[model samples]
Target: MSDGGDEGDDAESDDASAGTTHALRPLRTDLAPVVEAVEATGADAFVAVGDRFDDDLRYLTRFSGPDRPYALVVVPDGASGDDRENGADVGRAVCCAPALFDEQARREFVAGARARGDGEDDDPGDGEDPGDETNAHDGVAREVRTENVGDHAGERAAAAVAELVDGSDTDHTLLVPSSVPHDAAVYLERAGNELSSTDAVTAARARKTDAELDRLRRAQRATAAGMARAETVLADGEAGEDEAGRPVLRWEGAPLTTERLRREVNAALAARGVRDAGNTVIGAGPSAADLHYVGDEPVRPGETVLLDISPRGPDGYYGDMTRTFVVDGDGGWERRAYVAVESARETALAEVEPGVPAKTVHGEAAAELAAYGFDPNAGEGETGFTHGTGHGVGVSLHESPSLTGAGELRPGHVVTVEPGVYGPDVGGVRLEDLVVVTDDGYEILAEYPFGIVPEKRG
Candidate 1:
């Protein structure tokens, strides 16, 4: 939906990470345009009468309270809590706080919220302690009127929205987002069939806020340490079994293994209050060649390994990065390919800027790859490097404002710049980093040393 085109790559993602946001954190400046756009779209006071599990939910309403796994409403303040069966802007958002997203599942959820003895006394600030894990001055968790309210996610949400819509005395329209699951849509319809779909929510998340960027940067810096630690594990020597007989990676026998290293990185990030969900991208030999490969095969001497580490930043901000290294020593065509990737990567980076289109950057990288001895476009039995130059990185590993194929670059965007040369014959070599786009230029979020000189191949 953004002006950016698809890069010749496949980096699909879903909003699965559980994130927490702090209050008094500058309200997202980007969200304003979206709310304005929503109002302009002829919708009455905008109703994100759906679930809260994706980036849009986090971006629009700051609904990062304890995980409820259900549907919600992004109703703006000054809205009424009454129903608008005919659709009204009563200036309040009514939400059913269910735990699931099924249709029949959510109706019961709304019934539960209505059945509560303190139903009239509900408030978002009940048990929430924003100072705990949230960063906002007006914490979303602290604003909870219904925590763990029901079993059906979207149904509960629709019931709450329907009630608000009916109660409101002003004529208003209800809006839903494309991110809402179809099942949830059915639930909203069942409630009264009054839900309308729109792209406002996702469009708002496409661009990020300053406070979000700050947290993303910090999370990325922590990821750098994790990446360095993974490389450091390989830097020690061949990965083998330890005295305990576990297949551990030994950095001078201090104790290292794919699993152990994974725990270490998570431990490192957790110490900084950043919880993680996935394993570090430490793949060895052929496995490393595959993008996003998460296996943990031990690294043997004289083999190339890829280390792509993406860790969560404070709240829900995510940091993504990639670096390739050889175990024992560097040699053969591997080193040459790494140099090629680094060149292609920089070539792309050089073209990145506010006014410049994203296409130029990908084109430059592709051109550099073609100019190199490696084949940028190979087919069938013989192919080298088949992926995009980069993509957007934020709440999710891949978000918006991509850097692939062809697309216009915009300010306030954060994207990755990774280029690679992969093939069955030559394995793979790639380097990636997170960058923030400014009005004139961009800044790299993840910092690492490029072009490592191997003393010898193990």
Candidate 2:
């Protein structure tokens, strides 16, 4: 259930020149509806303490960075006809960054705007000259300005919020997302402005734009490639006797461990320019029954191997998929469980559509599982089907509007439909697919064939 993150000290990057390109929809177009929603709540401005890891902030600003640079962006309301239409007024979407990393912030800010399909041509000098701060975004409806907040960025952001509130009524509130740091929240609250959580901002991000879908598609393609590699290794594994004279699976004259399979999958994903960010789950034998187990034991033939890989692409969007395969599997309970889980996944996916309650989707999968003689509630810990049917996937591997419970599915909502059953004696069987909710149905992103065993390639 938990995803992995990069280890080591975080440092700021060199300058604007170190920036990388990302695919994005127009920033203003994405934020317009969000701002309107926030404004309806009586809030005058929306603020997010953004970084490369902040998906909500990245959705609004399109400013993912190479540096772990913290930035604050303020979007105020009620500027002009065009500005109101676009949500934030042009040149008023204020971005504040540390003085040392201001150039990187500026590069991300402008790159986001330029990447928008509706925006004018990109300025060739955007990266070369970071000092020339322009109020206009050139081709888009709104503009962004980057400023250095000096030493204390949070205090500066509070002051900026104070300025916005002062210009308007004294009752003006600044909307912040749930990820805002406690100290930052306190500073903004102490600055005489009311602080509020805006679900609108985060909810807006659950829906994928066309540009986002492309990145997700590419990411899933890479994930499918990794799955093929893992299955290949499993297929090539040969039955043998271990040092203890027990049965085991060997690949290339060596015992195949879960860690070895995981490494192989990771290598394949890395070759495709995708990183797992620690959500790669490779478990085999009885360990697979634990769901989250990253198995370390030597794999044995005829035991189920559950491989779940959710890798993030270069564009920051994530692709999640899970499949179970048997190493020259024993044809018995494993085959039955695999068929049940696969059927449950299909049942759940068929229920996905705009306006459908998420709980209904989960119910469909559960019903299918139960129909196949697998009860979701009968298992204590490692029996029957376990966990939610699905969850939203986007910039973050898991997001809001879970398919396990209430919440209406909408178009642009991308989610994972995973149905599984586990038992200590029989290992586990699980099938997961990433899909986008459509008006009438859903579009599957992970296109790899769902097979219980892989055929050796020519």
Query: Per-candidate RMSD vs. true structure?
Result: 10.0, 7.3
Candidate 1 structure, TM-score to reference:
0.72
**Model 2 lDDT per residue over 1-458, tens place:** 11111121111111101133344333332555555655578776777775667777776666666344454545444567676456444324556665455565565564444432334434434444443333334322333334544434455566566565455325457778878878777766766668888788668778887767877877887787777788888888889988999999999898999999899888877777779788788888888887777659788889888988998985578888888988777788899999898888877877788889999989988999899898876555757987888888888888977987577998899989898998888688888878888777778764667689864421
Candidates' TM-scores?
Answer: 0.72, 0.85
Scored by TM-score, the top model is 2
For residues 1-458, what per-residue lDDT tens digits would candidate 1 score against the true structure?
12121121111111211143333233332233444554567554344433335666655544454255544454443333353233333233333444332332222222212212343334424443322312222211112235436446665565555454455333345577667667766665665555567776555565666767777776776666666555555565555766667654456655444566566567655655566658376665676666666656655555566767787766577888777877545468787787788888878888878878877777788789888787776553355667777888777787776666455777777888888877654467888887777777787764556644322211
Name model 2 segments beyond 4 Å from true.
1-29, 66-69, 80-91, 114-151, 167-171, 378-380
Q: lDDT for model 1, on a 0 to 1 scale? A: 0.57
**Model 2 lowest lDDT segment of ten:** 8-17
